[model samples]
Target: MVSSSSTPAAFVTGAANGIGEAVVARFLAGGYRVAMVDLDADRLRAAREKADPAGERTIEAVADVTDEQSVRAAISATVEAFGRLDAAHNNAGITSSGPNTHELELSAWQRTLDVDLTGVWLCMKHQLPVMLEQGSGAIVNTASIAGHIGYRNAAAYAAAKHGVVGLTKTAAIEYAPQGIRVNAVSPGPVQSDMLEASFERRGAAVRDWYYASSPTGRFASLEDIAHAVHWLASAEASFITGHCLSVDGGWIAQ
Candidate 1:
């Protein structure tokens, strides 16, 4: 059930920056036709241009994963552009903080779930049908350290990511018979623009703590998380499915 085409294609959400952006480059380097989706049209276009200045093998999709119609259209566009859909990365998500579950606002909770958990579902909702039709495909969801364990103030984000982990496993099981593999990548601490801003807000002390906590003594580079994701979609990981691969540099072990 491997792709017959010499060059396969991939659809990646949250592709404007961070790990998503890194994955876009990774797939391109692997000789893939990539459709990069992000909510930020400008940033996404910039990424698309930087990734493929010649306007070949890359499509910029400005779509929101949280909206069902938007998600469907984006997938459709990807297929139209690439002639087939072989892989997907449900990587778009938002971070939300609540003092605690009790104090968490209903709206905040709902939005977090909508973007992080339900968004992945929607992407699968649309992408699975295409993969099912093609009879083969792969998908990777970006879960987090919060999904595997507790992070005190991030109840809402944790809940949503945990849901993503469950969803990934469910899809993997259901689609195994049809040659589709669904998996997740959970990262503990990564180097991204978001982390920089978060640390700036949380102060140097907290930032330093995250670095020292990593057994490797530093935050994960964007490529660290991206490479794991790229592997899951490649032939090397053909036997791996429904698995939550932890690229946490031993943070999970601690």
Candidate 2:
């Protein structure tokens, strides 16, 4: 049996809820110390309370993933708390609302790239050195089904996620020789708060159509994505790098 104390330390962003929160919980259960970062202070507190009832191996921070200073500080805090950074899940992101390619607002498009694509770049900029110094680490980035296929009124999101996949592959190649692994996870329609908000913005019928179209006959659960992330970040995936693992319930396959 693997001992909890022997598990490597991990840092996760967007960890206040949904898949991020579930990943934190799962990693903790597996005996790893984790640093959780989120933009929502109250939600972050709640997640900390629930995941680290004893506060023995978890640290929670409120930081904006899109801000360089904030992300840098959060990474610093993680190192401070955990003594070393062994793994990271850069999972914070936002969606675009019906921003079609032809009519997408420039500001909206820029914001999507800033948070989704550039944010991952910034996190990696700060995280890679820590891993390089240690000569071993793994990083899993959150992409989306949009990353692989173009969906109507989601041009900004698709473009940004594509950028994430591109970046992951590049970094994976650049640092693979240095004992670092970089990969990405693209999820389909999961029942997350992000989806709920999208439904409110796009209407129930459209959201229902998304759910109905999944080959799995239903949307993915948070745990489904969490489990995939766990494997990608574990020793089992040491040979996997520069790859985009899809946990989309065959959404893209079909």
The model with the greatest lDDT is 1
Q: Which stretches of candidate 2 lie over 4 Å from their true place?
A: 1-7
TM-score of model 2 (CA atoms): 0.96
Q: Pairing residues by index, what is the TM-score of model 1? A: 0.96
Candidate 1 residue lDDT tens string, 13-88: 9999999999999999988999999999999999999999999889998999889999999988888777788889
Off by over 4 Å in 1: 1-5
lDDT per prediction?
A: 0.91, 0.90
How many collisions between residues are there in candidate 2? 0
lDDT of 1: 0.91
What is the C-alpha RMSD, rounded to one decimal, of candidate 2?
3.0
